[model samples]
Target: MTDFTHMELELEAILHASNDNIIVTDDKGIVLRAIKNSEEFYGEPSEKMIGKSVYELEKMNVFSPSVTRKVLEEKGEVRLLQKTASGKTVMAKGIPVFNSDQQIVRVISLSHDLTEIQQLKEEYEKLQSKVERYESEIEKLKKRETPLDELKTKSPIMRKAQETLKRVANSEATVILFGESGVGKTLFARAIHRESDRHLQPFIDVNCGAIPASLAESELFGYEAGSFTGASQKGRMGLIESADGGTLFLDEIGELSLDIQVKLLKVLQEKEITKIGAVSSRKVNFRLIAATNQDLKKKVQEGTFREDLYYRLHVIPVEIPPLRERKEDLPMLSERFLHQFNSKYGKQTTLHPETLAKCLAYSWPGNVRELENVMERLVIMSDQPVISPQLLLLDSSQTDEPQPWMGIESFDHQGKTLKEVVLEIEQNWLLRAVKEGRSTYEMAKKLGTSQPTVVRRLKQLQSDSK
Candidate 1:
């Protein structure tokens, strides 16, 4: 082919590749060729319309107000919106191609359908509306908030556990709380549920160990009416179904039987459950938080716990530090519980410094729960305003865990001579004896000295200040 013909083909190829829908027709409005996209724009492929007339296409209601006819009549370019048979709209442009005679030989047409862009705009508006609605709901949820101050911790290990809870509170991820018993795993689970979007819904907390092994399956998965002996007349919803649109906390989940573990795994995988005698399953949805004081991985290895179920519950493992590891929080926790009990029982009880010292010295075998019971006992049983040190050791002898006892320092030796330190210790000992209402004879007997010597030494120490 000649260079002019080659350049012409190249130009046509560039026009066809352009984003615009280009159609070429003779001056008589007979369709000769059209770009590929024009078929989607008009609902008819270019090959089928190669020899068709634009007049017949208009009569067939393909598109109204033909731009090709306007270009022929006015002998110039025409651009306007055309209505399609699908009730959608398009922008069409037509230009007359003339030869050396200045008379029109062909009409070049380009059009674009606005339906897709319009649909996208509409969808964008709908998405914006949904976002606004959710933001408003979150704001309302923030107003009716749970007592998160209970979760405020002092130790670094406990802080890390709180962070994990906050991050997963708004999601559907399963969380497993690992810690010793009485470390507040149940409290953490409830906090997560209250802080979540499903706060308004029920929070079903089930303790696998608390329920008997004989009734465990029926209690968790429910039973149909008359399904077994002594069954309820009407079927009851189990803990799993009762937590729909909320949260499910399975405390001591490690204690569940292997048979129940397999069924629980199926419920998690399918998000549905069938009653004991029911053929069809009913759907349920809830966030799951599992807690265990036992070694679950060991159970998995021993075939007591299902491996699949362990992995499902182990999605986000948060280990809460036992109270022994975070002993620094003991003082604050003790004060809070003291005030709590004082207000609860309408008593004006205060913790004695000696009592607090003994509490700090002993390792918390039962963790926060033990402290709570201890404080409540002090408040209710104490007759005086200040609790006595004698009562603090009520049940320390029978505790399950060993007590790595710590003793309070008598005095600090910084910037002090040995004689001064000894004198200070003697004064402190005498003052403690006075606070305990011990006479000189009792003090002398304990220190292996005479009563007159104790009286004379106490008088000398008192006179040294003057």
Candidate 2:
């Protein structure tokens, strides 16, 4: 080829090199040449495609009216959407290739794949759904505002906890949820049940403390029609029976009397329950999840909770740290609650950064429940969009102004000794790590230590803090 012809050829190659799939075909629709991606998208050998009718490909669906045929008949160009063999959607533009005499020589089709467009569409739909949910939640908030809905937490600790829940959700082992009251233990338990294999089945929640001593046993195990004087005409199935093949969440298990604890232990061991005033024993299959604000170990030692039951429930122990422990989550929780309250009140609202900082600084005695209540009150009462710290009622009496946890020390005065301060900081970090649900492996990797050493230190920190 001459220099000018070589330059023309190089330019043609660069133009064709554009990522779009290029298929050159004759007037009869025979594929004369195809780009590399054409083979990938169509799952066909490009070399073999030569001399073969392009419309014969499964994706092209031979009889279908397409841009290729349109360009050939009109002796012009046409654009249309097309599908590839890999189920990929594409936008194809077909232009008639003409000779110097103006005779149609072939057709050059440019295929622009719609992979990114489809992904963007999906993302848009997701964001739209989220916006709708936010609007709906706002409307609900305006009606009868509940503090629970206002709960927002984005702390790494909370994230790790959610991650762990997702991991063991399919397991059948008994789960003991340890946390202070108002820490949303029941919420976590319900979330787990919803994500578990028994999602379709009933999730019966039993507040052991709420159930009367007289009716507790019958309510849990159920009674026959004539088992008790007040029994219904039809035999009543107990909570245990109702939760068959599902999950039975026992809240405040520490409150269950020793006698009842014995019966619960038997059910856990034997996988069966005998109803009050009933002769026959019925087999039951249900996962057990127990939660408590009280110290279960102390209860066991006090001759209240049975040791066997404690061990059984403690198999998959999940200790939820108090709100004060996971201080980092406070801002997220506050913001979430603000959004929830904003929707309900039909008012645009936001939290002042300073006000939120005070909330995080304050030692939450009542845990998450307390924070939720405070946020709810702020939402309902505050006329301004931004909630201020003054609304929280954190006076000097309520909290230490200068030093929240400890009294302010003089510059010359010795407050906490060097050892005490170091120990306190260490305890706080260790507690924070544990509260964040850092596994032994994860903690070791982060702390630059072996797993065993991390585990040993964590146990020691917990003990020392206690």
Candidate 3:
């Protein structure tokens, strides 16, 4: 009837106006009809989409198992997650339409774009990962551990640091790396240099502590040809001059004397350095990366370090944590070192579960450097394919062992030889230290001795007579 046909046309038009994407396909999976909403969703005209295969429009569906033509033959209904050409996620539901003979004639599919929802989800996950990563990274940084090497966790820490570095790389601001020793301050300085626009220019590193007071000025600002008795005939380029249009890393900057600090502050403020015995000053266009393990605030309070210089260098303070606080990263760091040492030592040695457990238990006082050395030693000295605590000579070293000295005395102490008594004490301490995750430095500090002394004592104890 004319009335029935009019009603059907009206219904189709209403469905086409709906926000959901509506598509009609023949039983063979060929697109037969597409609603106006579908045209909007696919960013394609309805006329073009009607004649094309739905699979042809979606390219990323090759790996999906739900979009096959066999689904229409086997199942009367199917639901799947699909992505559009523009990488937008969409949820699609398909249902078979039956004819008068109770046989499937066409399949009607409705789609709802989930791009915004999925993007929100992804953003939330990224934020959560960043929070965890920074927390982990800050903890690791405090302990002189590189999150990249230790946790291998990708978050926004390094990315943000890189961005910050970019923002200030060309500026003349003094960037002081406030971190513990062995925290890769020099590497970060190099990174800043490499990322700067002056990447091709010279990059020089000067250890302020290593230079003598008499030579510090000449070494930094250069000297005239006949400045001193031992000076070269031709004036040599100092670190500052060598770093022209580039970067200079002044490591252990806290060790600089008051006079040098004053002169350095002047150079930073004036953007010029006067060489020793030079009548004139040379304008230096370079970035300064100052690193120090000492507490500048305390040094300032003690009147040893200049407050103005401290403020100048503290413009962008990058603090690096030591290794003990980022214990969660020990496993990854250990594995990396294991792999590296395995290759370097020409051994296929793998860490034993117990040894790994010990490594995690021990606090990394010296951070990555210490961990690398320990792994190298283990790989070289270990005999078995897999390293075990027994092979590490850790029976007396607390590298792996449980402590039971809280309450009762288990070992016999009566009439024991002096060596035996010392051995028992060492064993107990080592066990306790392992449980506490105390590094050699911590133990040495607590026992009032240097790290080398503690190491020597541990080695001697390991070689004790059983």
Which prediction has the highest TM-score against the true structure? 1
lDDT per residue, candidate 2, 38-61, as tens digits?
566566667766778755653455
Q: Which ten residues in a row are the worst by lDDT in model 3?
A: 146-155
lDDT of each: 0.78, 0.71, 0.69
Top candidate (lDDT): 1
Task: Spell out the clash pairs found in candidate 1.
Answer: none
Report the lDDT tens digits of candidate 1 across residue range 1-466: 9999999899779777888878889989999878866667787777877889888888887778789988988999999988767676788999899999999999998888888787797789867855664566456445433444456565657877888789888889999999999988888887888878888676778999999999998899999989989989776668888777878899999999988998999999999998888889999999999999999999999989999999999999999888877654666777778777888788887666546545654567788899889899888889999888788764555322432222236345667788866765665554444333335666676556777776676545433422
Q: Select the stronger candidate by TM-score from 1 and 2.
A: 1
Candidate order by decreasing TM-score: 1, 2, 3
Q: Provide the TM-score for each candidate, comma-separated.
A: 0.55, 0.53, 0.51
Tell how far residue 57 is off in model 1, in angstroms: 74
Local lDDT at 316 for model 3? 86
Candidate 2 — worst ten consecutive residues by lDDT sum?
404-413
As a whole number from 0 to 100, the lDDT of residue 60 in candidate 1 is: 81
